[model samples]
Target: MKNVYIETYGCALNKADTFIMETLLEKEGYKFVEKPEDADIIILNTCVVRLETEERMKQRIKELNKFSSNKKFIVAGCMSSAEPATVLSIAPNASLVGPQAVERILEVIKSSERKIILDGDKASVTPRLFEGKIAIIPLADGCAGNCSFCITKLARRKLRSYPLREIVESAKYAVLNGAKEIELTGQDTAAYGLDLGGTIRLPDVVSKVAEIDGDFMIRIGMMTPEQAMRILDDLIEVLKNPKVYKFIHLPVQSGDDRVLKLMNRKYTVDEYRQIVTEIRNKIPFVNITTDIIIGHPGEDEEAFNNTILLMKELRFERVHLAMYSIRPNTKSASLPQIPDSIKKKRMHIANKVYEDVAYSVHNEYVGTISRVITTELGRKGSVIGRTINYIPVVIKNENAQLGKWYNVKITEASFYDLRGVLV
Candidate 1:
């Protein structure tokens, strides 16, 4: 069997895609390798979320080019989808595949071709899980919405959902293999099943997975506000599932309606607030987290202030804040960009606010006891693990194994993590 090494970058969805691709290659008589040096085939699963991420991918491609003279190098994922032409320019002899082309990975690996663009013609293929305590079931591919700053449209062109039965079987297989977490991932998870023949919906998928008797937790991936509003009742029911983790990672780009409109997000500030309010109202103990981009092209002080105010009001348990950067094909890239100084200042403010919000939320857990699924043993005497609500807790336990479950009592809290005692 030919040796293959796959490297992944970007979100959990991308990581899941890499796993799927690796599975396909392995079935085609390829042996998986940990390092690129010993492999006959090297695949870099790319990301294009930020300019920096794309640049890093470029650097990697260039470095990988050194060995390309002797081995088969493949560039797959978002960077390949968004900038196939540029990728060709950098590694003039490599093959490429977009997010939509899972069926073609085996063919690409078998062939000795250059500048191959294997995109579209979507089909359902059950992905292979190689390792770990978590099983990522990609229920859907691509995204339905066109947020102005997003370049995902270049690669993840259409939203396609897998058959509900297929996804459920995949979850069962993973659980049988000792996976304690089953994460449902996609570009827009809530947009699942729209392209399928029926109106099955995302919650239906989650409920089905939860029905499987096990000690596993289900984590739902990113969802747009539009989808959330459409299936509010079903979503609420899914959140109430005991097998499902009590944490949601939602992206609310900005707080001002005008900025949201410019980004073509299709939802108003009030609409977003209502969705979040409903989620909180129904799942009171749920840990709500979000992604916030500071200093978009037209964000002035007032718009920035609105974001800060809303974040303070929501008290999001966690926030991934990024300073906006222009990408070539995105609609927002052509607009008059924000000044660097102003953007930096806004980012600083947003970071401070996010830290404060995180601290406040953490403080509430200081006296509470929660069950932790141990993931690692810390460098010191502490054991680190994640709670069902997705909170990272470090407990002083010297004997806990990596994949064991234990109850922990919160002893202290910080802005970034929590300290607990194993119960």
Candidate 2:
């Protein structure tokens, strides 16, 4: 039997793609190994969302080449589609496959010579069994936005949502196969069904998945403010289902309308604020998470301060903060760039605001009793679980089974996690 090792990076959608690739390869009699050194074939499921990530992928490919000269290397994922030349430059002999070409993984592996393949076909939604308690179901490939700073648009150029029936069936298969969590992922989950002329929306998809007969939590991935506004009422109604996690991941990007316009985001700051306010009003204790990009092009002092003020006003439980870096071929890259020193300074300020708000929010849950589902094993004989609102609770128990629910009493809280004891 041939041995293969696969390493993946980036978002949940990319992780789902890796899982699909593995399922395909395993059926072809390939034995998966934990380490690259022990395998005859090594695959790097690459991510190119950030400039640093692309550089890291290059470094990793170079290092792997030195470690195993005889092994066949395969490069797959977003980098394969967006920057195939750079991938080839790093590993000339490696077979390259794009994100949409995941179903063709077996073909690439069976080939003896180096080949560059990019089908750019619509994504497939065939149900496949995964060997884990958490099953990531990608609802679609690509998005509808044309953000100036986004490089992913170059790779996944169109929005192609999976059939609602297919998605529901996939969720059923995953739950029946022992999955405790069903994570619905996509480039922009809220933009689902747009390409199909709005026959269905993300809320409808979530409601169908929640109706599946199983003990699992459904985690809806990131959604843009523009799309979310279209079906905000329906989305909130679906979120009220007990099976759905009360976690909202909305990426506002910038808090100033001028910066938002410059980034090509369709919504204004006031619109984003209204969406946040409505969701909060409906679910007061919901864990609201957001993404923020600092030091983007044309962000002046006042604009940056506006972001800080919005962060303070919103008090987001978690912030996915990033410093803007130039991506090749992106419109933002061609414009006037921000100085690295200023970017670093802005990042520092954002970090301080995030830390203050995060600590304050987590402190509120210290004395509350939360029902948590044990999701993963943690450090030093501990198990980690998540509350309905998706707050992570760590308990010191070695024998905790995955997918089991427990009523945990919150004993302590930290900046990032909560400590609880099972009741």
Candidate 3:
């Protein structure tokens, strides 16, 4: 059998797409290889979220070109759909496939001539039974937002939520196959069912999935503040389900209303604050995670300070910090840009503030005992588990079994993770 090597980049949605592609290709008798050197076919499932990521994807495609003379190379994912010219410029002979065209990966692989397949929305593909203990399920393919700094919207345009029944069935399949954690991901999970009608159906989807007979914990993905506000009450109600993880990934891009308006984010800083406050009030001790983009265009010193102040007030358990980089064809790219030095300085300041808050939050968990389920093996020969709220805890015990629950006593704490011992 011919060997295929696939390397993926970007978020959980992209990773889920890779898993689907692998399952489809494997069924066609293609053996997956870890290293590109050992494979007859190599696929780069790319990401073009930021300028740096696009450059990395181009560089990887260029490097893979050397092996193109001997092996068949395929370029797929966001880069393939949004920036095919760039991919072709680096690797002319590589077959191109889009994020929506994942189901056609095998057809592209078997073709003798170079192919460019970038059509269809394969959002309904109930991902084959994942071999891992954690199953990442894509609830939808695209988002409904038009954030000015976002290039992903260009690639994955419009919202296309998967059928609720299909998603629930996939979750059931995954749990029956021994998955302990089910992560429902999308471009904007809160915008689910917007395209179908006026009503938001994310709460309904989560409720149905929670009904599935399983011991798995469900992790709801990132949601924009505006979208979350529409169904905030229902969403919180669904989150209260014991099967759902109390982790909230809300990307309040900027803390200043001016910057938020410049970025085309619908909600203001006050609106975002209210959402955070409400969620916290309803679900006390919930692991509230947020994303922050520092140095976005038109962010002044006062604006940046506002973000810092908000971070201090929120005390987010985790912060997905990103430095604003120019993405081609994005509205923010055409705006007056921030200096790299200034952006770097702001990034350093934000990171330091975030680290302080994070360390303090994690420190609270130290000396506390919590029941956790071992999910995966950690780096440095430790077993990684997560509390009911999705707080990552690393256990030093070698005897810890994957997908098994244990009472762990928190012994140590860090800015990012907690070290614990099995009780």
Candidate 4:
């Protein structure tokens, strides 16, 4: 039995892919290694969400390539599918297992020579991966959107929504295995069932899983604004369930209509606002998080300013800011890009606004009492938990137990988390 080391990057779905691979390998009598230096083989589950992330993956692959003599290196996920030339340029002997071909990891690992499995493979439900109190169930793969700035669609090119019954069964298995937080993830969660003859939608899946009789919380992953709006009424009704978290991730990309049109986002600033307004009207305590790419092609000073104004108006509970950089083969990459200096400046400014607003909003949690579910251990003997509305709280008490609910009084606040004391 050979020792294997696996490192994963990107979203929950990627993590799940790594877990599935590990599970299959372990079942076949392979050994797990704690460090890449000690492993006979190493796998890097990669992501290509941003240009910066792609660069990081390249450097990391180079560093990990040193551990093997037989070229027993594997690169998994979107980078393998979309950036095969770049990956091979660095680790020429590395095997590629694409997003759609993760089920073929065993073949990639066992072959004596370099192998690539990127297509004509199917994903089946494997054992759910749960650590501490969290479990991630990838609802499906691929996205329905064709945004000009996104390269991820090229990798996960098919919209394959898993069967609703299978998803429900996976949820049941997770709950039975003591998972306290279940994340329903995909490229576009709202794009679910577009190929299923319109029989089932995202809300139907959520509602079915909510009926699984568990103490776990259900988190819906990122969904396109336009796609989400189509199911808004039904989605809102299902989110009212006690087990589902009132959180929505809608990436507006930019606030200016011209920039959005250029990016092919399929939704305007006003349309994005309408989705938020509707969600907030029904679920007032909802935690609305958004992603903002600081600079994209066609974003002028006015466009950037419009984004800032929109952020102020939305007052998102959390804002994930990224400075745009060019990616190959994308329409935006062919256009005149915003200067790196300008992108950095806008990112810094937007980040400051995001931090200030987040701090102000979090400060309101001070002196409030709420019940939180202990999910993870944090720094300096602290325990991490989430409020019903999904506000992360760090309880500095050593007595807190994972997966248990505790009523606590928030005594301090930071932009990232709230400090709570057991009540």
lDDT per residue as tens, model 3, 208-315:
888888688999999888889999999999999998999899999888999999999999989998998999899997888999999999999999999999999999
Clashing residue pairs in all predictions, respectively, total 0, 0, 0, 0
TM-score of decoy 1: 0.97
Evaluate residue 164 in candidate 4 and report its C-alpha lDDT on the 0 to 100 scale.
85
lDDT of 1 by residue, 178-202 (tens): 8877889888888888888547999
TM-score of each: 0.97, 0.96, 0.97, 0.97
Candidate 4's residue-wise lDDT over 120-207, tens digit each?
4445655455566787787788878888988888888888888887788778988999999988988789988987877799999999
Q: Among all windows of ten consecutive residues in candidate 3, which has the lowest summed lDDT?
A: 120-129
Query: Could you tell me the lDDT of residue 242 within candidate 3?
Result: 93
Give model 4's clash tally: 0
Clashing pairs in 2: none
For 1-423, candidate 2 gives per-residue lDDT tens digits of 899999999989888888888878777788999999899999888899998998898898888776546998888889988899888888788888888778788888888877677665656644465655888888988899999999888877778788888788888989998999999999899999998889889998998999899799999999999999999999999889999999989998999999999999999999999999999999887888999999999999999999999999999989999999888889999989889999999999999999899889888888878899988888988889999988889987666667899988888887688998877
Off by over 4 Å in 3: 129-131, 198-200
How much is 230 displaced in model 1, in angstroms?
A: 0.6
Assess each prediction's global lDDT (C-alpha) against the native.
0.86, 0.88, 0.89, 0.87
* Clashes by residue pair, model 3: none
Q: Is candidate 2 or candidate 3 better by lDDT?
A: 3
Once superposed on the true structure, which residue ranges of model 4 sit more than 4 Å away at CA? Answer: none
